[model samples]
Each structure stands twice: as C-alpha cells, then as structure tokens.
Target chain A: MIIQTEALRREFLVGTRLRRRRVTAVEDVTLTVARGEAVGFLGPNGAGKSTTIKMLTGVLVPTSGRARVCGLDPVRERRELARRIGVVFGQRSQLWWDLPLVESFDLHGAIHRVPAARYRERLDECVELLDMGGFLRTPVRQLSLGQRMRGEVTAALLHSPELLVLDEPTIGLDLTSKERLRSFLSEVNARGDVTLLLTTHDLPDVERLCRRVVVIDQGRVLVDDELAVLRQQFAGHRTLVVELMEPAPPLLGLTGVVDVTVEAQGLRQRLEFAPGATTAAELIAAVARHVELRDVSVFEPSIEDLVRTIYLR
Target chain B: MLAPYPQLMVAGYRRYASYRQATLAGLATNVVFGLLRAAVLAAVVTQRGTVAGYDLPASITYVWLGQGLITVVMLWGDQELARRVRTGDVVIDLGRPWDLQAAMLATDLGRAGHAVALRLLPPAAFGALLFPFRWPERPTTWVLFAASVGLAVVVSFGIRFLLNASAFWLLDVRGVIAVWGVVGGVLSGLVLPLAWFPAWAQAVLRWTPFPALFQSPIDVFTERGDAVGVLATQLVWAVLLLLAGRTVLARGAGRLVVQGG
Candidate 1:
C-alpha cells in the first residue's frame, strides 16, 4: 500500500482548566491506498480529515494508533517518509516567500538531496506542465493567488515523490484557475505512479479527478466507495421539471412522484421520483393527461446532490 | 561526508532571504543595542583610563562586535527548533533521511551568515568609524579572535537549540527563552568586560561560557590573552555546550508528542 492507517487516533488537550479532556480528532481511521491510486477524502469541517492526513503524511504522530506511508512508520522513520511523500497544506505555505520560484526549487532539491541533473529535468517538466513560463523569476509573495498555487504544486513535486497529499489544493480558486489546475493534476496523475490522497470540499474536483471517495463526518468514516456507487446508493431518482403549456390543474395524489413542488407561475411544477419506482413515461403521461404541457425535461441528480446526501447521512 | 556544506549553507541563506525584512529588523535591533553599549562603555572608560585589557577604543569595538555577532549567531528569538517540535514541523523533519540537529544547525548557519553580511558588518564598520581602534597587535591574536568568534557562535547556537526544544513541554516558550537571554546576557560579557569585573566576578564568569562570548572577542581585539589560551578556552566551551545541547535534543525528541491538527 502506498498509504495505510490502522485504527488511527489523535486526541487533543484543550481549554485552560488544566483538565485532560480527551477530544479525539480522528478515531479508528483505518484506510489504505494502492500505488497509483487517487483517493479523495471527503469530509466536513472539524471531521478530522486534516488530522488523518497529518498522521498519514508524518506531519503528526498518531496519539494511540499507527500509520505507515510506503511501509515506513511516521513516528519512528519520519525522514524516510518525508523523502517518499510530498505534501501541500492549502492554508499554510511551505515556500520561501520572498524568493523567486527557481530559488525555492533549489532549496527543495537540496532538502530532498536531488541530483543536479534530476533537479533540472524536474524543474523543466514542472515549468512546462504548470505553464510557469513567465513567472520563474517573480518572487512568490508577488505572484497572484492562482500563480502562487501553481508554483506551490511544482515545488511539492520537485523531488518526484511517490505519494502526494494535497489538503484542498483547489481551495479559493476561480473557475478558470480551477479548471487549469484540475487538468494539470490529471496529466500528472496519468504520467506517473504517484499515489494521490486529496482531502477537499470541492465536489467538482472529485468528479473530475477522483473515482473513489471516502466520506468522513464527526471524525469517523461514514462511507467509502466509488463516486459512481455513492451516487447510485443515495441518488435513487432525479427531479423531472416539465413546463405546462398553460395553467394546469394540481394533482394532489400521484404515484411514482414522491413530491410535487409548485412554481409561482402556477403553470409549471417540479416532480421528484424514486429511481426504480417511477418511470419518465409515467410521470410525463400523468402530467400530460392531467394538464397541457409546454415543454419537458428530465434531470439526473447532480454530483452535488449525491455529496449532500453523503454529508446529511 | 559533510554532505556538500555549500548547498546547505546556500539553502540557509536563501531561507533567511525569505524573511529578509524581519532579518533586517533583527539586525537593526542588534545595532541599536550595540550603540547603547558603546555609549555606556565610553561613559565608563572616561572614569578609568582603561578597564581590563581594553582601552576605550577596544571597549567600543567589543560593543559593536557583540551587536554584529548577535545577528550572525542568532541569540535572540532562536526558538525555531522548539516551534517546529510544538507545531509538528519537526515530525516531517525527523522523518527525512537527515540528521535533525544538523539540518537545523545548517539553517541557522545560513541565517547567521546573512545577518553577518547584512546586519553585523554595517554596524561594526560604522562603530569603527565612530570609535577609536583597539585591534590585535600580533597575527596570533587575530587568529585567536577568529577561532574564539567561531566557537562563540557554536556555543550560543547550542544553548539556543536546547532551550528552544523546551516547547515540547511548555506551550508559552517566550518567557523561558527570555529568561535564558537574561542569564546569557549577564554571563556572556555583552554587558561588561570580564577583566574589569572584580577578581571574584572574573573567577565566577571565567568558569562559565559567558567569557567565551564578549570577553574572548574583546580579549583578542585588545591582545589580552595568548593564542593558546584563547583557542583552548573557546574550544572547551564549544565542545561542552554541543554535548549538552545534543543530550537535551535526544531527550526532548523522546518526549515529542504532537496534538491533533
């Protein structure tokens, strides 16, 4: 396994009372990722996602459990783990703020003991892939937010580590920057065996990059499955919005339609149905036979809906 | 293998460059303190023709040297090791296939180098222009001065490393580091010359590493001690302090416990 955690737990001592109140930030988080697997960690705030990533990446020592990255213990063999993995914490930066991107790369290369030749090759590849053609000389502090994030990703990959742990790499990005980064990640993933473990709140990121997602809430894993399977489990049916030609009569009780919410126009209504219980034909027939139909459209539950279901669950 | 000391050194320098403004501020603070000390020493020397082996010129040099070296040696706010330990950055550091202490020492060396060039040299030169000269008469004294200054950096860095590791136990470390600074100030000869101290005071301060700091540098500048004596004393303190710091580092690492993020 590229990454593995066994009954991982982390407790914190908080407040000023000098009381040892054990608050478990992560509890029994047993997980595994194979080489070349890109697993998305989905969780709400305070759900211990960052905590788990910290322990797994050797940023934090497990309080009462064990974690291993590439078969090295984070606590006992931290340096070795550091060599094999690269990490990016979205909130805090690890770059040299006042230096140009190239200088930061030099420091990273030294830290990882990368050979001069390899450093050049990696630098070239990163610059091309990240489209950092014009900004290599710009100091990190002066770069735009998107530009800086790209530089950060390049720095994290300087050593060509086997695993990459990104905690919300796409946070606070505009639509254009987000799409650019997403494509860059996809290309990088396709070209290497680097196992990626991402923790994020962006559902589109999951949809674009990760096929498997592990949902966490209250410091526990609520669901871990393929994104498709998750949608299948929670999103049993889709809402069918059919516009009526004119003002239609209200149907109080209808089969297959779990709910019928009315629009202000009084001519159109939203119809929700269970996946297997209702067919599009039946709903349309019911609507058409009862009222004049101006237009018809069928909508599947969006990835947003499935994620919301996961969070609600 | 020393593992390409230049690379490590460059990395350290660039890291300080990242905190350039803060480093400059720290250097400025050192220079200000140096000016105050120079004024104080000048005032004292007016009363006595010479205190210790140093005349008024030598005393002024000592003040400037102390200020310049503070930036180079990082005696102030060097709780970095402790912060890394407390914040879990040390975990990543320890997980690397490198010596923990060596990595930190390398970074500090880089930062110290920057401080010396940018902070120390300017004040020292400015002080030299403003004050009279009290330089070493012999080449041997010059050699000893260099050795003593280098050893002083090592000793001071070792102590700061050990004290900084206390963040493993204490949440608020500024108070503890502040106390350490005060104690070091009293002993390190940054405040007063060891030679001018009463015989009893010299006897006490001589036994500690404080003389190795300001006194040894001043002694070399004023050609007070022989080459052999200066080298021996500085080396002794460097070795002893390094051993103590390493022992403390090992113990502190064992007690490293990281909280949840």
Candidate 2:
C-alpha cells in the first residue's frame, strides 16, 4: 500500500479555561490506499475528514495508533515524508500572494531543491495542462479565485510528489471551473504515477473521479466500499413521472411504490419506488390497470441523494 | 535537509522591497520622531552640558541611531506568525520540510538587511545633516557596532518569536503583543536613552536583556561604552532567547498536534 493508517485517532480540547472538554476529531480510522489508485473521502462538516487529511500530511499528529504515508511515519519522519506528497487545502493557498505566479513556482522549486532542468520541464507541463500560460506572470493577489487555485495546483506538483491529497478542492468554484478542475484531476490521475485522495462534499466530483469511497461521520467510519456497490445497495430509489391522457382515480395500491403525489389536476402523477423491488415495466403495467399514460419518465436517485440518506441514517 | 533558507531569505528580501510606499511612510515617521528627539536632547544639553557623560553631539547621535535601529530590529508589529497561527494557515508552514523557527529567522534577517540599506541609513544620513552627530574615534568601533546591531536582530527576532508563539496556547495574541509593545518600547530604550535613567535604575536594568537590544548598540555607536562587554551581553542574550524561543516553538508544535491543527 502507498498509504496506511491503523486505528488512527485524534482528539482536541475545547471550551473555556474554567471548563475544559475533550472532543475526538478522528477515531479508529484504519485505511489503506494502493499505489496509483483514486479514492474519495466523503463526510459532512466536522466529520473528521479534514483532521484525517491533516494527519496524513503530517500537519496534525494522531493521538494514538499509527499512520504512514508512502511507508514513512507521518510524524517522526515528516520531513522526509513531505518530499513524497503534495497537499492542497482549498480554503487556503500556499502561493506567495504578492509575487508573480512564476516566482512562487520558482521559490517552491528551490524549497524542494528540484533540479533546474527538471523544474523547467515540469513547470512547462503544469502551465500547459492547467492552461495557465496567459497569467503566468500575474501576481497571485490579482488573479481570480479559479486562476489562483490553478496556480496553487501547479505549485504543488512542481516537485512531482507521488501522492496528491486534496481537501475540498471544489468547494466554492462555479460549474465551469468545477468541471475544469475535475477533468484536470482525472487527467492527472490517469498518469499512473500519482495516487489521489480527494475529500469533498461535492457528489459529482466523487461520481466522476473515484471508483471507491470511504465515508465517515462524527469521527467514525460509516461506510467504506466500492462506489458501484454502494450505489446499488443504498441508491436504489427511482422516481417515475407519468402524464395521463385524462383525469382518473388515484393509483394507491401499486406494489413497490413508496410515494405518489398528484399534479396538474390529476392529469400528471409522480411515483417513487425501489428499483430492485419492482421493474419499471411492471410499474407501467400496474399503472395501466387504472389509467392510460401519455408520457412516462424514470429518474434514478442521484449520488447526492444517496449520500444524504447515508448521512441521515 | 532541503535547506530552503537561502531561497526563503531572498524571497523575503524581495517582499520587503515590494512594499515601497509603506517603506517610505515608515522612513518618514522615523525621521520625524528623530528630529523631535534631537530637539529635546539639544534643550537638555543647553541646561546641563553633560548628563550621564553624554555631550550634546553624543545625545543627538544616540537619538538618531535609536531611530535608525527601530526598523532594523523590527521594534514593533510583528504579528505575521500570530495571524497565521490563528487562521490555521500555519499548518502549511509546518507541513514544509524546514524547521519553522529557523526559516522565520532567515526571512526576518532578509527584512533587516533591507531596512539597514533603506530605512536606517537614510535617517542617519539626514540626522547627520541636521544635528551634531558623533563619529567613533576608534575605527574598530564601527566593526563592533555592526556586530552588535547584527546580534540585536537575533535578540529581537527571538523575543518576537516567543510573543507570536503564544498564539498556540492563547489563540489570540493581540493582547499579549500590545502589552509587549508598550513595555518593550521603554525597556529597550526606543523612547529614551537608558543612560537618561537614574543610576539605581540602570543597575536594575542591566540585569534584564532589554538594553542589549537598542541601548547597547547606540552606546557602542557613540563610543561611550566598552565594546567587548556590550557585544558579549548581546551575544549571551541572543543565545539564551533563541534557545527559549525554540523550546516555545517545539511545545507549540506539540500543542498544535494535540489540538488537531
């Protein structure tokens, strides 16, 4: 495995000086990611997702158990481990705010002690891949948020770290920028030299990028499984909207239908049912027993809804 | 072993130069205060020819040199570390391979280098034109003065590093820093020369490290002090404070780990 954590846990002290309280931010998380794999870490706010990433990157140490990134202990060998991983915190930037983007890249290269020739080649690659050639010379403070995030991504990759960890990378971007970032990340993951661990609240990002996911809540793992299997097990609901040719009596006795609501003076009706309990053909045939249909559309439960159900459970 | 200090230092120097307008405003403020101080010293000298072995020229030199060292040693408003810590941006810094204290020290050294060339020299040169400024009689005093000023930077950085490191525990260090500013100003002799204090008070002040920050450097510049003794005091304080600051930093890092920062 390229990454491994065994019963890793972290707790923080909170509250006033007069009354201290202990809150466990991460607890008993044992996970592993193989080389060249893409995984999504999913959680709601205050769910220990960020804390776990912090530990893996050596920003925060686990209170007990053990964590090793690229086979190196994250705390004791952090300096050596830093050279092997790239990290991006979406809410903050590591680039020099007042300096030109290229200057920030040059400084990072120097900090990592990248050879000049390799640095130039990698810089060129990032600039081309991220489409950053137009504003390479602009100071970071002047760029739009999307532009600055691109610059930050380029900065993290200048040294060719083997593992890339991103926390909320698409949190506040617009649709177009989010799509761009997702595609960019997919391409990077395609290179087969870097492992990617992305933590996000954005479901499309997970559906588009990850085949596996680990979901945690309140410092404990809730679900860890293949995305396809998770969808099959938890994302089983399908919505059916039917437009009838004429007003008819309500269809209330259909098997497998969980919900039914009338609309447009009973000319249109919507029904939600479990996909595995009954097929769409059976539902249409059962509905035909009462009223003739003009149009019918089936909507599968989106990844967002599936995750929300898991969280609420 | 990446040893990113050279690049960090150079980058810090560039950042210092980039704030041209602020630098100019800072220089103007120091010069204005320098003139005000020189006028007061001149009045004191007219009433009493010498106070604490300081003649009119030596007093004026002390005032100007004190003003010059203000920025050179970063006498006030070093809240970058505290701000980073409060905002949790410091995690990015900690994630880097280099030691945080050493890297910050290198960066501050670069800023001091720029201050000497731009902020400190211009005010001293202008002060010389307006007032009777004293020159060292012994050529070696210049070398010793330079050494003392360099040590002053280390001492000042060490103190500020501790002040900012308080953020790890306090979470908000503005109050601590504000208190340090008011007390450090008088104790380090930025407001008035330490020689102006009474003999009994100077005896007590000698026990603290504040004099090594500004008073000793200015005294060496005016050639009214023993060079070896002043420089030794600064060297000792510099070492002590640096070790203490490093201890604070290590403890703070451990706290951050415990607190899940």
Candidate number with greatest TM-score: 2
Candidate 1 chain A minimal-lDDT segment of 10 residues: A245-254
Each candidate's clash count: 8, 0
lDDT of 2 by residue, B103-137 (tens): 89988988898899898899999988878879888
Q: Could you give the interface RMSD of each candidate, to one decimal?
A: 4.2, 3.5
Q: Residue A70 error for model 2, in Å?
A: 1.4
Interface DockQ of candidate 2: 0.41
Candidate 1 versus truth, CA RMSD in Å, comes to: 3.7
DockQ of each: 0.38, 0.41
Which ten residues in a row are the worst by lDDT in model 2 chain A?
A: A247-256
Model 2 reaches an interface RMSD of 3.5
Model 2, residue B103: what's the lDDT? 84
What's each prediction's TM-score?
0.86, 0.90
Chain B TM-score for the candidates in order: 0.89, 0.95
| Per-residue accuracy of model 1 over A23-135 as CA lDDT, tens digit each | 78887788888898888998888899988887776656677877778998876777787888888767656676667877777777877888888889988988897889899
User: Per-residue lDDT of B1-261 in model 1, one digit per residue for the tens?
Assistant: 124346667777876776767867877777778778888888888788877656788778878877777666666677767777666666545545567677667766776677768877888888888788566667777667667767777777777876787777774588988887887776777667666668887788778877776667667766775757876888898788778877876777655555434
